[model samples]
Target: MDPLTPMITTNPFDDDKLREECGIFGVSGADTASAIVALGLHALQHRGQEAAGITSWDGHDFHTHRAMGHVAGNFDRDEVIRGLPGGSACGHVRYSTTGETSLRNVQPLYAELNSGGFAVAHNGNISNAMKVRRELIRRGSIFQSTSDTEVIIHLVATSSYRTLLDKFIDALKQVEGAYSLIVMTPEGMIACRDPLGIRPLVMGKLGDTIMFASETVAFDVVGAEYIRSIDPGELVIVTNSGEIRSHRPFGEVHPRPCIFEHVYFSRPDSIVDGSSVYSVRKAIGAQLAIENPVEADYVIPVPDSGVPAAIGYAQESGIPFELGIIRSHYIGRTFIQPGDKVRHLGVKLKHNANRALIQGKKIVLIDDSIVRGTTSLKIVQMMREAGAAEVHMRIASPPTKHSCFYGVDTPERTKLLAHKLDVGGMQDFIHADSLSFISIDGLYKALGEAKRADGRPQYCDACFTGDYPTTLTDQDDVVVTNQLELLAERVA
Candidate 1:
């Protein structure tokens, strides 16, 4: 077989060119925002790990601590969080989407905008950033970072709105695609979600204090009471008086949260939109066993993401589960290291296959999704080298054939192997004996009981089906500039 023949490289979309979205957390009315944010970020750390940053405002000024590493590594000493004193603050754990994985891209981006100023933390991607950036450049907006979140900073600075809330609302109106944001001004803290609800944001209460995070699990870690999600198209303000105010920009935009969150992104202990992610993954695994049954000596998950599904598959297929791969918890930001040699070394440092469990065995390997196919190919080779007789691949979800416009960064269709090859072709490409993906219906069913009417229970499957709840328009992509000037003139 010609290696070049199997390589699907003619993608109109650039390969190895996608970016991962980040996670944001903020709290106000608390005695120690730094310590609270550190603990909250620990719970939401799965959302991002490249860098961690926190900004605490002490009435007069903002004190910050930021570094390029895990929360534990970055804030290793108690004095680190304790040093930043404030009643309210905002923090960010970043997975860079546009910028390089350097300390420069780390978040809790603080800027002295208006009278007092604004510090921001953001989750999700802005699809129109390039377009917006070009226009901002024309307006003489000096950008400090390659991060799209910086664009919002520039927009807020230029807005002629009355309050910081007005500027935030105005800035959001021009952006498109997914975003769940947390911003801190001298006066208060603000939390907002996109009109389409592409990402998840929730509100919680810690006595008189108000909290906001990308996941409810963060609130739970801090002993905060869950107080529902920040609704689609909503902007919430938490004042010093502990008052919460809500605003809706486009109330009619359909609520379409990212489906990948339940399938593979979120922790099993976390719940989104009142649905359990663990049960959803397990159900999908059970459904996959029924839809694509296979005879195997043992069921092995790809560790981490595939564990729950593999358990369900084993129970449904009556196959015994085995721990075939061991993952090293001490892996640093290995993905940030450039070069294939470095990346390969990082992989070896992170995961090792157990030869005793896989040797001379017919094994079923279950994973979440195969993106780019590089990692999947390497894993298959690793299994074969470990003496596996035959490796059957089972995917818990359907193929990620399209790039997500929302937070979950994915390459264009041209770069996706599933978009280019059929199941058989994928098997040959990955060097697997066979490969099967769970059907869409089976996936939906495995997600458990989704409320048919939103009152029952439901989920967002836009990644699999591309049935977007809201349409992206040219207006949504328009950059904030003379348009704002015209609006100001009209108001005058």
Candidate 2:
């Protein structure tokens, strides 16, 4: 059997891409904080679906509910919303990594610190969390959950600082990685982004209440007016009386927000980092067309994720855009119940080639990315089966050659098809007539930059460039441990 066969390379149910870290939302000074948080979390559900949580502080006590499931199933009921009562609240939607998807790791993780109660909703991964966790444990700190977010709570609990704000600042100074945090204390709500701002966090307003969310789309969902982003290294403290204070205690550094948000993580309507996500994607597609033009009868998107780029490609290339492929979003999760073989064959259950529109047409297929190359293989096969004369593939982003450590859950380096193969090899493996990816410079140009600065830039492109801004202490420690064990065996 050929190793590169479509059956071997594809999975009908698997997207083979990076999963978003988490989405965090908070509202301070709102009358119905928890209820408004539910609506906001529902809007940001696309960010995560594995688990959801919300915590509310009503002047005296903090109330919380954490569950493993979509926000729609777990947080939509009026009774559930009523259980969490307060004028200030925060919530989180998480996509836990495989083998770590337990309810105990759900966010809005709470603790009874010396300063009353403290709860935090986090939207990033701490690269040095495990290293800090080991040290904290050695110092006799009892752990509650396996999540990295728990580290912040323990850090706050043990801080020598007198005030809650000081303790939080102490914690932020010690750890490293991407984080956009919404922390709730008895007195007020605290929102802060990491020094480099590798994650997205925005501030909005609904009347007198202040809102903090991972994206601007949540503001639209909850009827909030977009304000501006919480600048990297900056902290904004919102008091119970609606008093807001801003501080830049982390000092100055090159703020590198995640570029992937504009490419795929954020909703099309979202305005992230002062630019429209849809507009960035369209520009990416246009750049791709200018960089890699091909003659075809029609241009077709892979659907949903690929639509914006495809539209830009079609317009820029002067090719007619048509519905060459149709997607069935309703076929989610249900495909897993039919067993592996059925699931693989049923990739068509979710996406099928539009035979009528595609027949005899030479088409250019546009997609946001190709993670493991599996979906591309299947989509190309489906196009051929639908009587398409030629299928030329164009990717909106550069090949994702490195796995992400800043909260995004991605396949290991060995499993990444792009990391394992060159461009020609990928084209052969995916069975496309021609394949091209937007150059890294092209990607930056689409984001309205002349080109990404090699040493300093506006956003994190670590997945493509492999030039990580922070020290991956946890990952490096694991590698060191493995090397030590190998040396010990050789000595024996």
Candidate 3:
């Protein structure tokens, strides 16, 4: 077998789920800042698995180390942390939603600017990146990587503002999309969220140190006290002397954080938008039971992500909850499949049916969402093979009818199962006896909202409702064509 053979046999159970975007963690005014950042990134490992990088700024120089794997092997070494000697540091873990998975695309992208050395770790997509890239190239700006994040650096470099802070703000204003950024400069560390707040970022404090991360769970890992979420359009700057200042350059706007954070992306224990993600998921499951009632002998979760919702469903429906599917946490994202004969066994490497518990039982399966519906089909078949008399499927979220352009790695609109089929059609495709999903209104109710407003939704539910908050400039046909032409020219 070739060394890369395992890469071809990725876990089928994970393939059908939405890939997490990326994670960023930053610390300022702390001793051994790089080590603290490493710990924080470890806690946020679920957010991104492809690559990890850390950049630290000492009094004089900026030191950076980037690798094409998880943080453990790369940043855990005492020598590695010792080499990045600084009181301030920032790190990023990437899953490559926008850029290709390679060393160059790993973030905390550093550049030496006219102002000084600057580094940035970003957690969302810049929708106008292609458009801006073309314009920058036309104006003689050179790009070092294919990442959309590099565009921010170019924009900052090209800005005519007299001050570094002004240039940073100017660059942010030109881009259109979700972003929660932690920027490190010689002056200090700056953490900011986009005007819409589509992605999550939280502020925390550990003694005299200030920290910023994609999720609050990272703070908990570093023994930091959760401060509050970085407000939409707000920038918080922490100086080397421990002085902190806040600025809101983008002014006030209707904040629309990603609703799926509660549905799937965030760690269950993390708090998002002032609500516990675990509580919200349980609420969603309860709401699902209230809306779609079905009599079944057992309420079985699809595994990991489905566990919370399944518990809620069991509680609300007065049904017994059981571990009908046993998941193997030891299974890596990829495994060796020697030939076609072993390829079909990929799903079993991650999850296996609880044969004894599910045997002869009429079970209701709970899951977070149905993306392509392939995993659901396989799980349903597996249940039947385990002697399940009847299998009904319940989704905790509304049907994902559209693709997400804000950092999440989702299939194209045409590839989404919900986009192509209705409820009955989906049930038939998955070979389930019955299938139901939570309503859009029910999802909002679970989040403590009365219902989704007709005018402007409080959350970014574009995948389910197709109501994107920002303009997707790169998705424009004309801009895409121009971008291709520019790329071809560069290659030629």
Who is ahead in lDDT, 1 or 2? 2
lDDT string, candidate 2, 149-188, tens digits: 8888999989999988898899999998988999999879
lDDT, candidate 3, 178-290, per-residue tens: 89999999999999999999999999999999999999999998889999999999999998899999999987789999999999999999988778999999999999999
lDDT of 2 at 102: 65
Model 2 CA deviation exceeding 4 Å by range: 1-12
**lDDT, candidate 3, at 300:** 95
Pairs that collide in candidate 1 are 450-457, 451-456, 451-457, 451-458
Q: What C-alpha lDDT does candidate 1 achieve relative to the native structure?
A: 0.76
Candidate with better lDDT, 1 vs 3: 3
TM-score of model 3 vs. true structure: 0.94
Inter-residue clash pairs, candidate 2: none
**Candidate 1 lDDT, 92-157, residue by residue in tens:** 886543323556567888899766768888887676666777789998998777776787888888
Task: Name the 10 consecutive residues with the lowest summed lDDT in model 1.
Answer: 1-10
Winner on TM-score between 2 and 3 is 2
Off by over 4 Å in 3: 1-13, 97-100, 337-340, 478-492
